[model samples]
Target: MTQQNPLPQEDQQVTLISVRDGNISVTSARALVVKAHKIALKIDTALSEPPAWTDEQSLTMIYTHGERVMRLRGVLREQVDTDRITVEPVGEVKEGDRRDYRRADVDARVYARSAGTQSPTEARAAQVALQLAPTSNAFIPQVVNISGSGLGFTAHEVFSAGELIDLRLVLDQPAAALVNVIGQVVRAVRGEGDALNSYAVRFAELSEADQDIIVYTVFSNHFAAEGLSDALDDFDE
Candidate 1:
């Protein structure tokens, strides 16, 4: 079958639906429920992480009346026949709009704290990975440009512009450890190909504890791995 991108611009809301063989079918933005005579599906609601990108996994959906929702896995066969399913791309998600972009280009410093070491670059990298959750699977965001207020990177997922997401940055070293910060998704795209969809997100808020950890990391780096080194180096021998 032919694949096409239905979005007009970057960060536009887009959705891809992969349905189980003979379970549900979509044609031109309309979904049809089908009956599968050969496949047996079991609904699983407890999976914390959805199946990996390659895995033929099924999502549970509530059906009509007394029957429980069924779990539908990935497509197993060709679109015309058999056991496999297909992933249909739906364009124009309504999740967010341009006005929802609160800090897309704000000049705010972003940092990281892992196991207690502090490096602005490393922290920032960790922040990017954490915010891109599930989508940051194989691709890593490389900071192509940075500014006093905002930065930009190559994103791996087609994130809707102005979407919001929580992040958990981990800092762990031989001497210290911590995870901090939450971020909001600013923009994302699938430019050129699925592999090149760059995402751009900005730091929105940091908790007091996270702020302390960042300060501690900076001090450790400045003081040769010594905690609070920058704040206490004046002491006499």
Candidate 2:
């Protein structure tokens, strides 16, 4: 998020959600934060793909910090090349309690496979996927953010919406915790390139135990980030 008076801080990430004619699209091929005030949000298309978003497109920018989620409306101000976008906050920022399914931005890589949709997320399935991750059959993608119900990642492969996927996520926030689950692609977005780097998967038949594991990891990562920011402030002081 741009370090404007109300915006979060420099280098923070924000999700830009756009809806047009009854279709809701999570424009993730390219979109991130830099800084500013009164700036209309300029969401970018995938750097590899030619720009597709039009100027003056309205959007909702979502920024989550700790237990709070800040939502601000904005419009396309200016496209900063193909890799960056700037949004001018439109109205009063609405702050709300983060839902129980709060998400945390993360960086991790896990094993992925798409045969069809919807399968049981059992312990056995997770174990098999973990073993396969080091092998060639698995398409390893970089996991970006995660919540109890789903996760977001970017990869070279394309998985269409409603497609069921089997995932083997090994998270380090809980020290090499393994999450084996079947999820349906809620959103699959491509960058300018051939890669489908922006994908959101919603868990199907995720066990309560598995869900707890994700929630634990989410909180672990969230607090760790906050702790680091606090340390930085103290050092500066």
Q: CA lDDT, every prediction?
A: 0.30, 0.57
lDDT (10s digit) by residue, model 1, range 24-47: 211111123333322222212121
Predicted candidate 2 versus true structure: per-residue lDDT over 1-237, tens digit per residue: 755325644444345555454333344222244444544233323212223456677766555544345666777677776655666767667663344355787656577667453445443365454455433445353546898668888766677898877766766543455577777889987788564657888777555445545664565465456443332221111
Cα RMSD (angstroms) for every candidate in the order listed: 22.3, 16.6
Residue 93 error for model 1, in Å? 48
By TM-score, who's the top model here?
Answer: 2
Predict model 2's lDDT versus the native. 0.57
Candidate 1, lDDT over the whole model? 0.30
